[model samples]
Target: MKPAPASAPFAGPFALATLSAPDGPPFPALVTPDGRTVDLRTALGDPQLTTRHLLEDWPAVLPRLRSLAHDDTVERGTSAGLRVHAPVEPRQVFQSGANYRQHVIDLHVAHRAPGDDRPEDERRAEAAEIMDRRAREDLPYVFIGLPSALTGPYDEVVLPAWAEQPDWELELAAVIGRPAYRVGVAEALEHVAGYTIANDLTDRAGVFRRDMPQIGTDWLRGKNAPGFTPLGPWLVPAESVADPGALRLVLKLNGETMQDESTKDMIFDVARMVSYISRTARLLPGDLVLTGSPAGNGIHRGRLLRDGDVMDASITGLGTQRTRCVTEVTP
Candidate 1:
């Protein structure tokens, strides 16, 4: 055997910590704010480098950064501070549908509740009424989207002219760190390099059929637009998160909280999703899997993204990613 192709820079906890903007080559190595990108990758790869040695490399390379706390530097510098690129410019994007019970209930109510602005109490009562009446009657929906739609942090999500109601979704996306087929749940996290944030943009006009119920087409149309998958900030190496399933996820529109909840809200958690998704496709390093969004999306309110809208999405322990929207001639 040729040693299984060397497995792309697998490193220890301290090695993982050294990532900086513009660090790798061909593409500029990830750069640090105080100007040190060289040490991140080298430290990760060097067998002689320990956690303490890696810390020494930073202060020697960029003295100003030495004072910043490790957690602060990683957040303020790597995950939160770096000028990001998409998590992966892969060939495909996977979306999970009706993945949360609350999302399903929201859809049911949005489709059936009479169109009217009701008092907060009335809305609460109606929600309770709907919950009492709900039943499970659909498949576990999953869909595909093009990679061309992906844009990185600080990038503009260009709205298509054909888009009548573009919506924002705060989804947790995983960057596959290795290749595996029929991987067990116990081995799934090993395949994940880290997690990043994504906006699963939706084009609502293509989502529904006249007044008929929302179907896969609505979900697909709402998801597949150029510049739709705005991702990054940076990949917070998995070791940093105590439990991926427990992180709190939140999204804001121009600084106003829009979606706020925990990753614990998932109907299917991270381990199951990874094992399930990989059963069908052998996930390779750099391939991304978007773990699905929670309820509180704009489409539920008949509201959707418009020009000049700003979106801020974050997963606790994973740094926040932000983007601005602009209208572009739909090509």
Candidate 2:
């Protein structure tokens, strides 16, 4: 495991994480605000406790976790050297696409066809108008993501040999705490357990089907590669985040800042996105709703991921994720 970055300590009063030694099985742990870790399995006296188990009964278990956070008698250790895994083992993942206002506009301007005479300003204005209408009238464009794609925040990502244009998309993930079906936007947030960081890595080359344009995106092939999603240093309880819409998201590539934006740019806020998903599908505990990525993707910036590159992604209140990239070795 890579050494923890010298960044600010988790801002939340307490958070949850999955951690282990280099050769041991992963175990659920509680992270104190000061950056110390307590083994939940041992501390809670539930040897089989997992982060998912807590989320399954989040309303009932949250108070206990709060008590544990303030208990000074429990043994605690620094998380600096331990192997940190994705905080929750989500059973289902829902992802929103093109939900950021500026991101969509930038994509529109960057992907203009060859010899198109429209000025950049005109194209941007047109896209912005479309996005404003989407915010008011259209439903979010959401898709499913496989759980097998998840990896730890500090783990290594093996870029597949076939992916020619691998890119980075940093996003805020909402962790569900309660079952929600056909819920309204006003009640959607009541089901959210917390917030975390996710880097939705994509292979631009495989996003669309050239031969079957009508069939549209091939997300399973383009985005579901193992370790494609580097999620969580920890989960900050929703109560700890004063305003999810105001938090900042920043992603740096090889020490150079690439994406810097705020959730305020989202066309649809968390409540709207969650409620929209619940209208058609039942959202259960431990499920993740990725709000969507902001602008500054490699496709827009003209610089994609390469072998030995490092990405440091973070959101306010939520912890940081540092993932190193390496090209896959084919035998």
Candidate 3:
């Protein structure tokens, strides 16, 4: 863990993480608000406990963790040099797509016909109107993501040689603490354990089927490559978030601010998105529900990722993820 930023990563007194020493196997840990870390396995006297175990019984385990947060006798370690892994091992990943109002509108305007000469404002207004209608009448568009795509916040993102337009989509992810099946919007959030950050990397060129245009987008090919999703640095408890709908998301490429927007721009809020998914699939503990990214993706900006490009992504109270892009080397 790096030094705690001047501004706290989360509002919670403590957050959860998975960390290990150099060459050590990852283990679940608790992170103090100031960035100090306490190995959960050691602190709780359970050498084999993982974050998944904690989440499986989050309701019962939370009270114990809360007590640990304030204990002064527990030995603590600095996160300065430890390796941080994705906070939890999720069995299922549900990803929402085109759920950010401004992001969808931006894509709509950017993907217009080549010869079209409509004014930028006119095109944007038209897209906005369409988005407004969708928000009022349509359900959220979501897709499944492979767990293999998960990677640590600071890991290297390998840009597959076959992908011509690799891009980034920084998003807010909800970590499920309770099993939710056919849950309604009113009670959807009650199943959430906490929130984290995820950068949903995409291969834009592979999004559509060229051979069969009518088949539509192929998410597996475009978004599920190994290490495509860089998730977490911390999982801040839901009670500490105050209002998940208002968090700010910011992504920087090589120190240049790229995507900077608020969760307020989302067409479907967290509760709605979670509830919508629960209607079809059971959301289990440790599962991740990734809300869509905000505007300013590479495609909209005309600057796709290149080898050595560094992306620093952050969501208010959830911590930041800094990933470096490296081109895959073929044998």
lDDT for each residue of candidate 3 in 1-331, tens digit (9 for 90 to 100): 2423535667789999999888898999998877777889989899999999999999999998898899999889878778888998999999999888889888878777558899989998988887788788857889999999999998999999999999999999999999999998999999999999999999988998888888989999999999999999898899889999999999999999999999999999999999999989999999999999999999999999999999999888888888999999999
How many clashes (backbone N, Cα, C below 3 Å) per candidate? Answer: 13, 0, 1
TM-score: model 3 vs. ground truth: 0.95
What is the C-alpha local distance difference test score of each model? 0.62, 0.91, 0.91
Tens digits of lDDT, candidate 2, 1-331: 4746545546667999998986888999988867788998998889888898999999998999899899999999877768889999988999999899999998889767558889999999999888888877856889999999999998999999999999999999999999999999999999999999999999988888878878988999889999999999888899988999998999999999999999999999999999999999999899999999999999998999999999999899887889999999999
Candidate with top TM-score is 2
lDDT of 3 at 300: 92
Candidate numbers, best TM-score first, in rank order: 2, 3, 1
TM-score of each: 0.70, 0.96, 0.95
lDDT per residue (tens digit) for residues 1-331 in model 1: 0001112222122222322244532221333333334333333455344222322233243232233324343423223344446644555566776566566557655655456666655665665454344323222356677787887756778888888878888888876666657887788887776677788888766776666654325555666677788876555556656787887778999898888878877766676677877778776665677877888888886768888988888777556667888888644
Instruction: Give the Å shift of residue 321 in candidate 2.
Output: 0.9
